[model samples]
Target: MTDLLLNHRVEGSASAPPLLLGPSLGTSYALWDAVAPELSIGHRVVRWDLPGHGGSAADLIGPGASVGDLAGLVLRLADSLGVARFAYAGVSLGGAVGLHLAVHHPDRVASLAVICSSAHFNGAKPWQERAALVRAEGLAGLAEGANSRWFTAGFTVQRLVQDHREADPEAYAACCDALAAFDLRDRLTEISAPTLLIAGREDPATPPVHLREIADAVPGAALLELPGASHLAPVQCPEAVLTALRTHFDGAAPRGMEVRREVLGDTHVDRAQARQTPFTARFQDFISRYAWGEIWTDPTLSRRERSMITLTALVAHGHYDELAMHVRAARRNGLTPEEIGAVLLQTAVYCGVPAANSAFATAQRVLAEEED
Candidate 1:
């Protein structure tokens, strides 16, 4: 069932660390149905439809609502649910909102994951024309444009039925307004939360160059570009996204050299440890070899640098699930809250105020948890 007031669905325990899922522009919470099951294993999942998008009240931001206002609505929804702090994940416009929350309302977020979003949507005239068309007609008027940029032709052919072609017109127009007014290239370094940035390699809407700028600007962000995915990578390649999330989250715990030694290096191995449950054995192998050996051992980038790059990419592309995991990893990698803030400030120009504002709020929430 849905929460009538907040326009959200709650699945899993209230006591668990809340995971707030934000939908992309023009879409509803149904976008998260596939991934929510995987995430619900450990966290309470709260998926919300932004105002004017799904079951929420139909008040558009009028003509002046900012991305920060959208973010504030999310915070209000969480407060309504008694969620003091939560890990946030979002896609597209939702990702922008998550970044604002991290940068400005850091105390409310525990981690951030952003997907297929951009800090700045660029200044192309064609995009503006399309937005005008959507405003004058409806989302249907922009469906072709949205589909071309959002999905690979092959994927769209196969999965067209699942896409949000029937989404609300007013919601789509409001989101276009949010994107149009967003600019945060000068404020990338102000965000202090750890962030993970996930991108679809084939995403034409927010290309690799945008992600590169984000990676370069955010202090402790990491970037993971998934091949064979389009703008909606979370839906197109949920397995890879799940793997990355699991690795980042589990990697946040403090592991002594002794634990590392026992697992990977030469150290005493107890016979009883060998007889542990199959799940435990699999987890050990996953962590030691996949997480540590493959990711942690990569010499191309230091963990600290990776953290910075990841946060920037998240701010750029707006991948909120990975953003949260990276925020937690930033703490493990020794990044301070102030450094995160600096990154958000630096990225303000390239990404935009809406994206940066969300990044800042998410950072604040994650950093506050670290203090607690």
Candidate 2:
């Protein structure tokens, strides 16, 4: 389709890299609120509400739309933003989206992080039956059983249950149908991005073994088994999730750095390197380690989106020096001349005419020099 209307919010410094966060079927984008603040500090986190949930219309997806179709909707969003590639992380049905993207749209994915999710969530029969039940009785019918399966030992089910209870019945049913049809075990090896697979040992929904199957299939993928955690491990044991993300993103040769060099150019990088004295060394190190290495490398977001965020933040902060560098980077990241003008024009409204004028001046100069 030409456009997808699923509700989404992009937060963090416009200068930060873009990270896409997908919610599970029953919940809204609020599912990531706990971890978003920490992540947003380093990433332009894009939280999207699932279809028929939160701000999305209940019928945003038709009866035939599968997880692959859902992936298509996400890529459409990226295209609209002029984001050439991004990192992605999702839970449950959201995780299935990461899988589909990594398998089918590998070129657009920088990294893939799957949390408390599954490749094939149970057999099709259970999902079909759940879909039928919800269609007949609405989301209220699935609340109790779903709550029981999603958490463990002393964990309160009130909030999680509420997420399901408030869901749109028809949309929930469509998600169930999507799960019923999703099974990508055969194509696991096709995934090219750096991948992180997380599982909750206590999760009955998609147990650790199911996650192990995925881990075993995808070469070089790291699997972290969070002990005593349940299906909602991200909410139940968030620390484990954060730690794993850091380790994955902060590795020796981070995926983010590769994209960074590609976007920023060797001339810029060499200049930055030339100025890295001891005083400036730590400053550069922190950016490379945390900002570029960790946050940028997150398979959960994209490099193109990151360039956009950085450009916007520079405009907002009136940091024309950085803005000029990123203006050049933005083009390399696939922002068209027209698109870059649009970003600056939007900045004029929110940031001010002066900031945008400066940005436009720098961007126009860079575009002209490249043309020459």
TM-score (all chains, Cα) for each model = 0.65, 0.67
Clashes of 2: 17
Deviating ranges (above 4 Å) for candidate 2:
1-4, 253-372
Q: What lDDT score goes with residue 145 in model 1?
A: 67
lDDT of 2 by residue, 271-364 (tens): 8766654345446656766787677777776777887778889999989888878878888888898988988899999999988888899888
Candidate 2's error at 141, in angstroms? Answer: 2.3
lDDT of 1 by residue, 106-143 (tens): 88877777788777778535455656777687665456
lDDT of 1 at 21: 88
lDDT of each: 0.71, 0.80
Give the Å error, residue 172, model 2.
Answer: 0.6
What is the RMSD, in Å, between candidate 1 and the native fold over all Cα? 20.3
